[model samples]
Target: MTAGHVPVAVVGGGQAGLSVSWYLGRAGVEHVVLEAQTPVHAWADTRWDNFTLVTPNWHCRLPGYAYDGEDPDGFMTRDEVVQWLAGWLQTFTPPLRNHTRVSTLRPLAAGGFELTLATATGEEVLTCEHAVVATGGYPIPVLPAFAASLDGSITQIHSEQYRNADQLPEGAVLVVGTGQSGAQIAEDLHLEGRQVHLAVGSAPRVARFYRGRDCMTWLADMGLYDKAAPEYPGGKAAIEKTNHYVTGRDGGRDIDLRRFAVEGMRLYGTLSDGKDARLTFEPSLRHALDKADAVYNSILSDIDAFIEREGLGRSVPPATRYSTVWEPDAEVTELDLAAEGITSIVWAIGYRPDYRWIEASAFDGGGRPMQNRGVTEVEGLKFVGLPWMHTWGSGRFLGVDRDARYLADNIIDAHQRKSALESSALRASAHHHLAVAR
Candidate 1:
């Protein structure tokens, strides 16, 4: 095994990790970024081929690597995003160790952390005074046990593995989870001339464009994106929820299960329970549909209120509505995917962060990393690019830059404090030695 040390070790290499590195360079801190794959891991491998950013080009904030192009309002494709990140990495030529997966991160007896990494060459140990867990919010997929209970004939794949409809087996698809991924992937399948069953939960959505302005621009103008975690009333649950459901297909359109339903995609309630070849849904299907409508209405209400406050006289078209439901009061709950001729299942149930590598003190009872906007109780340890770490947009491309800068400054301050104490101790030791000699 090889061993080395750095003042700070960033445990990711996506936009967040690279962002932190940018500020660290300005601060002149000796740091290295450890990545399990190539740079921009998510953009490169996790998303579908036609995926595009929900946020516009102008919102691609990466500190010194801000987006510079003619189409600021345009959305970038997945490949475009990867290329941009690759080019940005060149500016700093960051000390990045690619394909180095961190197996464990524990506090060292001598101070700081011992990061055990598994690399191509062999096992490697990296000692760092300060550790930054910028390893993004979605590396691990959250698959439900029901997926295992499905028939052997059914192919189940998480949203991360889904590329296109043609890539899967021929037949109807059951898309579980109505978050951004589930919604978009369902639409992709439906447009590809395949029957799709989308299981939708209480997910909020907003129009992609209104009043000739992007919804994101309106949100940004209202300073809603700047809201901190404390500003959220329901603590962690509220903070973790993101208000994103827009689409980049069809020249940047709004996507929701309701719209998919109108487009002929069958919608189901949340996946509640399942047995072999059998799926059960919560009887709250109507409630779930109403909840979605309410969330959409709330978004529109906020936008209208903002427009009124700003005295902008642009008239908005009559609000679009789904105004429909399927089996509103059905007594049946169990769904047989095999009987329904469902061939594949796409699990888009969001991500559960894996912090097994980190020590116990670094996390809360709920497995969430215990940190105050990336600065933890562990003196030399910190975090960045986590949802609700500081703001509503934390963990997103536009907001990661701010969080990264904050953590970088925080790490630098810790380094300075350590250096100061060491200098004082050395001086005192020298004086004591001279006095003893005399």
Candidate 2:
């Protein structure tokens, strides 16, 4: 085991981790980032082949960098994002130790931390005054309970494992959950000549347009794309809260879920009645569309106001009121997967934060780490990248950038103050020992 210690250590090198590292570098702090996999491997390797980011490239940049290329509005393919991150890493030059896995973290007696890390070369122990856990949530693919009951002949794969349409079974595919991933996967599978059945669930309301202009343009104009914490606190929360449910970039504008229904994409309402052998469909997809449209419009209006007040220019168009085409409660019933030949189900349900690795006992009964913004009840321990960590934007890509920066700054301030006190105490103890010896 290596005997050295760093002042600060970061575990996980995803967007959140990288953002924190970038800020730390800018602060001239010596820190090390331990990445279990190559940077952006979660996005690069664990996504569908046809997948593209719903958020435009402009909003994709980590701290200390901006996606300032020719196609700012363009959605980045998984590979493009990986390359972008790699390039950003080169520019920032954060000390990244790749393929290093952190097993556990324990608080030391002298007001610091001891980290147990396992690497390809060997195990190593690292001591640090501060540690940041930036492991982004999307680790395991969640499957419904019914997955285990399926027949052995049936093949099931999550959206994470899905690469191309060829990986699917011969028959129709049942995609569960209608979040961004599920919607995109369903659309891709349908285009690949596979019959697709999508089990609708609680999808957040979304819009096809950004502000009065396209959503992408509005995001850029409002600086939501390049937002930093402490600057636009309200804006950050909005982006983080809503970014996960956004869809419709890769397949184009007309291919949005609402538009796709008009163009012959099968829309089965929520699947119910497990006992019934029959499957039912909603008469219209309007209810879901209406809810989504309203949310989208509200977001645009907010952006428009923010832009106008901030004097950011009219890069975004004014908000337009569009009539919703929703019809009340259409009864769609059970999608019988066993009877149909559909063998795979892709559950693209959104992620929940799992902080099981956080050993501090401050977690609430709900298993959520108890934190107020980045500060926790535990002394010298802090958290970043939590949903609604402070303001609305506290956990978005742009939002977390701010939150992490704030946390890093606070950590430095606290560390400096504590170090001074510790030095004073040591000197006092030495004086007492000398007097006793004399």
Candidate 3:
């Protein structure tokens, strides 16, 4: 079946796609947003019950919908975030097709592209002059090959599947990967007085507050978000680094792994191999902890420099420092899950992009679409919402609007050009016929 055609079609009705739709609407561009589920699906479904934004509420800017809440400094819980997203959707009321999944997309032989959408009723084909893919960067969770070797008695789940400590079976829990989700989930389990074992990765940690200001606010003020990925110290590779672990829960605070260790949470190094109930770990726990602290202090030092350079030493409070409260005396390289009473494992190793449905040559070896600020070499193809698309905030709610606006302008320009060319050809044909009659 054919669902007709459109000038523009946006895939994925998440924040990214909705932002683009808002811009297209403002410009009077006719477009339809195709979403596999509800627009607020991710916030509604994947997140844990207690999940809150690590960034401040003030950063929740989606197009014209800048956060106007009373608590700009506070974080929005999962439900609040969903409401905020839905609120934006209601404001514009853009054309949206819910429960419509774009199963495959390929460039047409001519100027447009063909999309195969799967819905509850049946399959439908739709063609569009331009397609904006805003399906986000991370789509699939990553798990170690050894995860399958674990005993069947233990319940294993990805971080996206984790809800709260009560959801897991009664007993000790082992949380792997110290990225943002891993670290925060470990803390959540620890808070419930569960015997939590954390397998720490090299992911860095950051202070929640600095100089009486939220760390994110200070960083923004310091122009960190304005810096492009390539301009970072490590260049483009820095864009791929795992986000620093911090939390805005309970009115915001630092996620200090060392503090958790001091409080009796068993910390292990990176998990290496697993078989049945036995798991082996590397002896880099101390190094990983130290490296995390070093990065944390380095950020503080940068803030201090920014304060000194701005000559706001008096206005801002004195610089605070983090101290190493606890460290592993020696590496505990192995643990038997059965003996340790480990009943569940939460794998927080992160996610990778899946562009397999998009049969286009715009992808790199790693499956990331190649684009410059969301505009690709493929004429009518574009992308949005990938991390570091142009700046540090590109994929985030902080700067997605800017990227969307740019793409909207590009689409408008293309339409104008096509109309002008067609008008010129029509006039030329008319003149030729008149000359032949004379």
For model 2, residues 194-307, the per-residue Cα lDDT tens digits are 877776655655455544345655555666545443456556454344343555456335234555555545566654333223344443345656566666667766776777
TM-score head-to-head 1 vs 2, winner:
1
Give candidate 2's whole-model lDDT: 0.67
RMSD over all Cα atoms, model 3: 1.3
Off by over 4 Å in 1: 233-237, 314-332, 421-438
Q: lDDT per residue, candidate 1, 5-70, as tens digits?
A: 888999988888888898888888899999999788778788898888888898887878888977
lDDT: worst 10-residue window of model 1: 320-329
lDDT of 1: 0.81
**Whole-model Cα lDDT per candidate?**
0.81, 0.67, 0.92
- Ten residues in sequence with the least summed lDDT for candidate 2: 272-281
TM-score of candidate 1 relative to the true fold: 0.92
lDDT of 2 at 269: 64
Which candidate ranks first by lDDT, i.e. highest? 3
After superposition, which runs of candidate 2 have C-alpha atoms over 4 Å from their true positions?
1-4, 26-28, 121-123, 210-212, 216-245, 248-255, 271-287, 300-330, 391-395, 422-438
In order of listing, the candidates' clash counts read 0, 7, 0
TM-score of each: 0.92, 0.80, 0.97
TM-score leaderboard ranking = 3, 1, 2
